[model samples]
Target: MLFKLLLLGLVIWGVYHFFIKQKPIEHKDKEADVMVECDKCGTYVSNKEAIIKDGKYYCSKKCAGVEQ
Candidate 1:
């Protein structure tokens, strides 16, 4: 009776520790994305989303002087 109870408690503890009590994984070394400034409007934007033209960065196609 005591052995069964102990076994049940151990199983519960194991499940809680493995599934419920674990912390989510985080990337510590992941750096923030770089920001670029538009040459025409001086607006700041993420490098990944900014428009590039003639070796200069712009916030939009119109600012970059590209017709679209």
Candidate 2:
């Protein structure tokens, strides 16, 4: 009886370790595709999150100026 219980416990532990306790290793890049430049500050930023106004582009509102 004790031997059967020990075997069942070991099997359960092995299954749990294989399925639940292991994490999958996923490798991917989370970068933007297009690159843009700020008009005022002349800083570069990704197009995915850059701010745009009228016909010009800037990294932020503070960088947008009258010269640009």
Candidate 3:
């Protein structure tokens, strides 16, 4: 009876340890993106987030002297 109880307790402990533990997460590094800087504000931004005009980069229209 004690052996059976020990086996059941071990099964429950194994299930809890495997399912209720925090898992390790992994993410790929995005190195294909280019980094850019704002001319007026001196702020850094990704190329995808910056505005391009006349071969120059800017963070926003207001900083580029294009905003009303």
What TM-score should be assigned to candidate 1?
Answer: 0.53
Superior candidate under TM-score, 1 versus 2: 1
Rank candidates by TM-score, best first. Answer: 1, 3, 2
Query: For residues 1-68, what per-residue lDDT tens digits would candidate 3 score against the true structure?
Result: 99999999999999987765533321223444578899878888788988887888898888777866
Listed in order, each prediction's TM-score against the native is 0.53, 0.44, 0.47
Lowest-lDDT window of 10 residues in candidate 3?
Answer: 22-31
* Candidate models: Cα lDDT each: 0.84, 0.73, 0.78
User: lDDT: which is higher, 2 or 3?
Assistant: 3
Runs in model 2 deviating more than 4 A are: 1-32, 65-68
Ranked candidates (lDDT, high to low): 1, 3, 2
The most accurate candidate by TM-score is 1
Instruction: For residue 39, give model 2's deviation from the true position in Å.
Output: 0.8
- Give stretches of model 1 more than 4 Å off: 1-31
| Model 3 TM | 0.47
